[model samples]
Target: MRLFTIGFTQSSAAHFFGRLKEAGVTRLIDVRLNRRSQLAGFAKEGDLAWFARELCGIETEHALALAPTPALLGAYRAGEVDWPEYAARFKRLIARRRIETQLDRARLDGACLLCSEALPHHCHRRVVAEYLRETWGKVEVVDL
Candidate 1:
């Protein structure tokens, strides 16, 4: 299964949707903890859903578990969220456990992890992608 992670921090809804279409993303796992945000286009679940449907034909779902868990916060404070170690633990949860069930549902159509960050390398999606590579290999990450 090919997996993708996409960022939406810097792009307009058009650009974001376009990237997803170009990547042939059939489903988007909204990984942001706050599905609603102060950001203009991203502030509501229904709106994004509508946009995705109307513009890109790609389905959107919240990847609740893919968002950083509260436990990850405690680890971050203790400096445990550093790349290698956090990536290991996060990979196990996201790729090998119940979280995979959620991702799998998304992937039934083709899926990518989505976050508000515009840069994939700076987001938790990067960490997840690393875990994906270590375990699954040869996946693509598209910053929409």
Candidate 2:
């Protein structure tokens, strides 16, 4: 299965949706702890879902099970936890949650994990993808 990951920061709406379209993303799994944010603009939950469906014909679903806890995210944002620690904790969180079983395997075939980090290098979305690849095997993870 092919699993893609993306971040919306520093990207225009046109570029974001365009990439999704080009990637043939059929579903967008939003792995964000908070779905609503004033700064998200076009990437806000409702707006993003609408645009994804109308423009790219992509289904959108928010999977909080893949997101970090509010405390963990807050600590990371507050500089209490570094990226390494944050990534480790996030990985453990997902492993404990057993997302490999919780998420439908078929839905992820052409799905892309969505976050707001602008890049997947330090994002939890990447961790989630990698975890799935490690556990399930044969998952081609592409960062878009």
Candidate 2 lowest-lDDT run of ten: 98-107
Q: TM-scores across all candidates?
A: 0.73, 0.98
Q: Against the hidden true structure, what lDDT does model 1 obtain?
A: 0.68
Candidate 1 lDDT tens digits, 1-144: 566777776677778788878878787777777777657465267788888888888778876777777687469658866756665676666765554334443353357778777777657777765665555456554444
Residue runs of model 2 more than 4 Å from their true location after superposition: none
Pick the lDDT winner. 2
* lDDT of every predicted structure (CA atoms): 0.68, 0.94
Which stretches in model 1 have alpha-carbon errors above 4 Å? Answer: 70-98, 105-109, 142-144
Worst 10 residues of 1 by lDDT: 100-109
